[model samples]
Target: MTTSTAPLPDSFDPDTRRVPPLGGFNATMLGIELRRTLRNRRTIIFTLVFPIALFLAFGGQEEWNTTVGRGNVAAYVMVSMAFYGAALTAASAGAMVAVERAQGWSRQLRLTPLSPTAYILTKALLALTLGALAIGVVNIAGVAQGRPSMDVGTWIASAVLTLICTLVFAALGVFVGYLVPSENAMQILGPGLALFAFLGNVFIPITQGSLMWHIASFTPMFGVAEISRSVLTGDLPWYAVLNAVAWLGIFVAGAAWRMSRDTARV
Candidate 1:
């Protein structure tokens, strides 16, 4: 009688290892987070209420003007408000994630079949969707008003620009969340992000032809706002687009690494 024993090639080979199914895992987590976030009235107010309120507040201003056609005070304020709204949503996602970590919630998630990569993906999708919806609503509401008119191209370009701006903020939020303790997340993130908005031309003009303007233009916050403003007003800034993407890429990569390391999953 002859007996043969062999190792399991498929099971033991790291080179051929199959990554966990991310799409389903990410989708499921996103769905759950959405439902949970929507149920919280605070989130609804921040995403929809404050931006709309700002639109109303600035819709009547006459001092504002942009190069874009019929781009009056109302349109300028509304667009900038939308940028702020979207940025806040991204920042909040990071803060919320931090809170979850502080409370040991992320640990609970880790114990599930969902891998660390899937968990990170879930946070990213939720943050992006929140940014899009928050900005979209504000923009639509502003347009509904008797704001200035822009060509269809300008409007679409503005939307794309605003999203690009929100991109870095989302990663920034994650970075902040990883660094801050749970109790401090709320206080630290809220004011810090808001200050950035103010400095970035969301609440007011950062002053063209000035040093501050030049500085703000290069900032991630300004990158999104400035590019969108240029595009929305028929100023297609190819250079600005590339620069903004670069800044976003660096910040996001750093933040992702930070989160993974904090979770001990890097």
Candidate 2:
């Protein structure tokens, strides 16, 4: 004879089960991500050193002593280098998802309770943390060099804007990571960012309203570069802000779309 199953309890409700907002993203996952990133020596060194080197190379020029806006050109260069470092670091941090995806780690994550939103959010926070570190190191280097001359208020504001603007690149990194194979992700991103930097006027100052300047205005890095320098120049054009907001929205949407596609495959 077969045994019969017991009846369901009155209090039991399957519909009551629900995932938390942001897929239950919290401090623990963020801490784990931060620790893992800190363990990568090459990333640490590259993010910290490269910008400082660039700053020292170009920011110390005697001609840069010419005063512009609220500070000298040396200060301007320093801010640019800081912004560059932050963007590079933030993008690299976000692109790390490619490595995890390549190793089948993302597939494994699908078995867990964690949602893609949580994973992406954790990575974004990690990117911001690393970006801030890059910004701080570059600014400290500028201070030690004593060539950069800007008021304390301008220094603080510029740094804050630089860090905030890096979120656009963080999203870009995530989108690129999902779009390309792991080995090729950084290969394309690294040089692509450098090119963006040049075209965006991060390396060389293009005169406002010039052909190159107009072209640079549409590039991803242009918004961040202009915003970061805005405090010193005492100008924050509406178009520059629009450029940044538009790119940020595009990249973030792209990342979410790609992440959905990736998870669907699993």
Each prediction's TM-score versus the true structure: 0.81, 0.90
Off by over 4 Å in 2: 1-22, 264-266
Candidate 2 global Cα RMSD: 3.3
Q: Could you say which candidate leads in lDDT?
A: 2
Cα misplacement distance, residue 177 of candidate 1 (Å): 0.6
Q: Which ten residues in a row have the lowest lDDT in candidate 2?
A: 1-10
Q: Candidate 1 local accuracy as lDDT?
A: 0.73
Candidate lDDT scores, in order, read: 0.73, 0.87
Please write out the lDDT profile of model 1 over residues 57-149, one tens digit for every residue.
866666545444436556667677888888888778756777788778878877766776677677777878888888889878966875655
lDDT of 2 by residue, 1-266 (tens): 24386745645766666666667788987898899888988678758998999899889787888987899999999999999988988888888888888888889888877887688778888989999999999999999988889899999999999999999999999999899976578788889999999988898888989988898999988987989999998888898899999999999999889887885442
Report the alpha-carbon TM-score of model 1 versus the true structure: 0.81
Lowest lDDT block of 10, candidate 1: 64-73
Q: Clashing residue pairs, candidate 2?
A: none
Badly placed stretches (over 4 Å) of model 1 are: 1-20, 23-26, 64-70, 236-239, 263-266
